[model samples]
Target: MRTVREANRWAAVTGALLLVALASSGCVALLVGGAAAAGAGTVAYVRGELQSTLDAPFDRAWTATVRALGDLGMPVTAQEKDGLSGRITARAAGDRKVTVQLRKVSGTATEVRIRVGTWGDEGASRQILEQIQHRL
Candidate 1:
């Protein structure tokens, strides 16, 4: 019984320290779950990026993202794409860097991630995502 108590205490301390380390490293996560079931999307914000699973194919999603950037008047600095993944780098107003990454999740789903600036601007990221979704 004493040994068991000691092990439990050590585990609790280790878990708390891990959480503290992650928090101090500027790693934060917010999960907005259950949207997929409602035919919308599943979204998460983590580590200065907004991630979402869109109900669209990778090709369609990639096209929508490119068009969205153009529609928003953010000049595309760079774009790279293959069959499985794609990335778009753009310059927002004031030259703030924006990045959009996409991966093929399934035949009917694509994963999208967006980050604005260095640390991240959640509002701006969300707006970009909304624009992409609008095109999709």
Candidate 2:
């Protein structure tokens, strides 16, 4: 009887230790996951592709995108639009290419993505996106 009691107590202690180990590992996983997400956002910001969702219809957003390009003096080299989506490609001085993509998210919402140059110029892309938002 005494030995059985000792064995039961040992088993309970071992189970508790296992649970604690699992809980601590979960915390580590959460920290790593959060760091990964932050790193991805930083990389995107550094890459110079600016994205925004605007409260505007697709046609209106498309028009604003074109106007923004022109306002920045980036001549539109190519453009196409349909009921659901549109894209405008342009070139600025120094042959920097700019692309603006507009996607209809809903009847009154659009997602705009802008990238400047092949390697992406953060300042230029941000300026263009802000211009489009202002026009919208």
Candidate 3:
């Protein structure tokens, strides 16, 4: 029974109210999605890669990353490191390429990102991350 303009106004008000309610309740993640809502240590699929933050110093995490590559029988083809970040590129089974990146988050925290194959093989990436975590 309401006119189009009136109905549109009502809809806008309803949306604004919903946003305010979600913000106040700290449930705004319903709008953000994925790891933003899941908290740290949660493996997230992002940009065709799997990522997770780790609780370890950069130096230690870097070492574990190298060890993990060996433990998984992946041959490290190349590696590069700087004070703030590093990357390890390896060849996995079936000649699939894997790349692991370590970024310093704090003195004792690092963010790890792994991608397997060109587009990304989620299962392989997750397994590689788990192996690195285990080594850590």
Pick the TM-score winner. Answer: 3
Give the per-residue lDDT of model 2 (tens digit) for 1-136. Answer: 9999999999999999987886787965556654653331222244567766777888988998899889999999998888899889999889988888888878877877788888787888878877887898
TM-scores vs. true structure, each candidate: 0.72, 0.66, 0.75
What lDDT is reached at residue 123 by model 2?
82
Q: What are the per-residue Cα lDDT tens digits for candidate 1 across 7-106?
A: 9999999999988876777553311144343343877788999989899999999999999999999999999999999999999998999999999988
What overall lDDT, based on C-alpha atoms, would model 2 receive against the true structure? 0.79
In the predicted model 1, the residue pairs found to clash are: none
Number of backbone-clashing residue pairs for each candidate, in the order shown: 0, 0, 0
Candidate 3 lDDT (Cα, 0 to 1): 0.87
Number of the top-ranking candidate, with lDDT as the measure: 1
Compose the digit string of candidate 3's lDDT tens values, residues 32-126: 75445234476678788998888788999999999998999999999999999999999999999999999998887788999999999998898
Task: Supply the TM-score for candidate 2.
Answer: 0.66
RMSD of 3: 6.9
| Total backbone collisions, model 3 | 0
Off by over 4 Å in 1: 1-40
Better of 1 and 2 by TM-score: 1
Candidate 3: deviation at residue 67, Å?
A: 0.6
